[model samples]
Target: MKKRYLASALVLFSIGSLFVGVSAISPLEVFDLTEDQLHILTASRFPRLISILLAGASISVCGLIMQQLTRNKFVSPTTAGTMDSARLGVLVSLMIFTSASPLQKMSIAFIFALLGTFVFMKILDRIKFKDVIFVPLVGLMFGNIISSITTFFAYKNDLIQNMSAWMQGDFSLIVSGRYELMYISIPVMILAYIFANKFTIAGMGEDFSTSLGLNYRTVVNLGLIIVAFVASSVLLTVGMIPFLGLIIPNIVSIYQGDHLKKNLPHTALLGALFVLVCDIIGRVVIYPYELPISLTVGVIGSGIFAYLLIRRKAYEV
Candidate 1:
């Protein structure tokens, strides 16, 4: 499994290294490159590729962390109300912090994302079913409630058009200045890797972790903080990218087993590959124009979601 993921990661990096822009210049051209080609690659294509890879890996790892903490394979920001809460936070920023800087708006979104995740955890604690399947359903319902409120406010303020622009994920807008915020996910992902053992222990149920002298609650809180930060960063940078989180982790665990440390690298690599493939497709499918990544991933991810639903026994983590 490790070899498989390493190979996939190499392939993804190689493909990304080769592909240059709408111009589609070759690597040989890159070595003997003209000034114009160098500028295009350095200023535009490189940054966009970096952003896509980071967003994919970060979000997928976030999902894996959320699943481990909750002991629910289905729980993720997309399914667990985190992204919706972040979106609501963005909307609130637009309303109250009308004159706020981008950093300020992202700060507001991060706060709401943390609160929403806390609320979802509380709901997870209270739920009777406590099954992996039930958790996401509850999360979906919770997200819908939050989404409805956001839509209402958007309509009332005549900002629905603006809100819609950001509601879907589009990689085309990711140039040098706009996509740097995604770098925030890198350190947060490193934090998750650092605390991987604690997360694994916490996933073994609270009582077992307590018996082993682990501060289960603190570990859980730390995990949630990482998840919230990654989700909000991605949401604010690329708009809401659905299903990359939920799907990538499950796929990784299929061959990697449930060990968080063992799976983290694979999850990150596969997540980046999956998103890059989707983004590349979105670019070519419509030619001169482009499809939003959210739409492209949504369609493919929905199919994967249904397959996971049908093959539930195969994904018991």
Candidate 2:
């Protein structure tokens, strides 16, 4: 949880991620590398590693923002219909824009993801019951409905195969030219850090923010826009990596406390470290073969989610 320890872990795993693939590259080979090895390092390894780090850090920070705005630790893109709606937007893009560019596709996805998240927030406003756990359950149901609609349309239009590719998160296909879209997350993350204090104030509740002369609605909307963009960008680039956002922030808050500004750095570092470690395990568990990141993260994240739920329940009792 300390900055020094987290930084050390991030550096170690990032370096390890660079060398764990099918390519036979080593740290010592850095000084003298053949053309083939250099190509492998630059074309595949480096890009994949960069995507993993950005996707992990960006999504986890987005999760922290959502939790702050919603005042619930469990809310994230995964549970809040953001990712599902982004996938739906992707399907719509494939159907309408046969030759859509990456940026165009991401734009559409961002719009839909934002809309879905906004609708969920509206529902939250209307509900009188503010159960800690039930709000996200409703969000889950909403996302499932959107996913079902996307699947139905995908089947009718025969785009199910293409849609399936974006259903799971995998970095195996990442190459230098293919993964540049993920860079969009870098600026979004910076903006998140910049607005950290406002988000902290916003999370204290709208009435509290109003008392402090903050424009609560504007801050909340800005936070959602950030979440939507990051969710859309990652979905467009790497597909859905469930619970990376949800669990990482919660874990960070456990050690770092609930202040968004204080917790941001740890959340980002831990998220990247978690993904890098999972990706390495996926690469080696069946040598020369690979497991998709979604599966690996899903298995581990779901276990952590269950534990968190149990802990929350125990506290209630």
Candidate 3:
């Protein structure tokens, strides 16, 4: 019943998104759209909606996978250096392949993201006792080191201005051709769904999964690949949407429970709904001008993160 509400709300917001921009179009006028209005709907609004749904769903699922595998509620791409590494990869592309297409940039970013995440997992392996807060804090420190390197290179090569485009997530610029790369995450997410049970067992820790006849290392590597791939696609397409993968899964786990397969659909829907709400808020906040989706989501996600931190013990994550 609650799931129905979530799905209905998502549908409603999706329709509402089509009419929220500077160009005036109404639900009532849909059948009578002027050529300009039709173009706006087809070109900008629809693309933005699809990007939002894809990004929100994919990133949120990535966070869920991270938390499960690490056995830490706070772990996510935002904290774990994945986004920072991708940004660095993008900077490298701009410096070397000045005429690089979006696909080239995404491919490079995926490789760097995968490597960075692998390094973090190795760091996780070194920690004898993984304090819940301590683990992600280490990741944050690692990400900051990566960010510092990215900034240094950007300044050295005079590419800081180019790098700024990826500093925040925005949907206003999305149009047909540019956003198709985000579709890559769709098939990747289906792969995640296929491996959900293995992921669930892998989350039970190395000894437990091994005793249960699961190849723990293989599952963990597969999980990291999914996370890195999804993070790269989203960063390439939407820029950085912080705390998205972190908060959405925790929220769903509260209501839907921790089974990855059971929670996947709920997490995806709620994530899309949350991002759509934030995007709508960003659009309407100043009437003609708009806030960045990063700003709006950051403000809200941080508040919720604070609440979750306060109640972390109750959640036992």
lDDT of each: 0.86, 0.94, 0.93
For model 2, give the 10-residue run with minimal summed lDDT.
15-24
lDDT of 3 by residue, 166-206 (tens): 98899989998989999999999999999999999999999
User: What's the distance in Å from true for residue 215, model 2?
Assistant: 0.5
User: What C-alpha lDDT does candidate 3 achieve relative to the native structure?
Assistant: 0.93
Worst 10 residues of 3 by lDDT: 308-317
Clashing pairs in 1: none
lDDT of 2: 0.94
Candidate 2 segments exceeding 4 Å error: none
* Candidate achieving the largest TM-score: 2
| For model 1, the run of ten residues with the poorest summed lDDT | 12-21
lDDT of 2 by residue, 241-292 (tens): 9999899999999878899999998999999889999899999999899999
RMSD of each: 2.1, 0.8, 1.3
lDDT of 1 by residue, 206-256 (tens): 999999999999999999889888888888888888888898888888787
TM-score for all models, in order of appearance = 0.94, 0.98, 0.98
Q: What's the TM for model 1?
A: 0.94
On lDDT, who's better, 2 or 3?
Answer: 2
| Candidate 3 Cα misplacement greater than 4 A, ranges | 313-317
- Summed backbone clashes in each candidate are 0, 0, 0
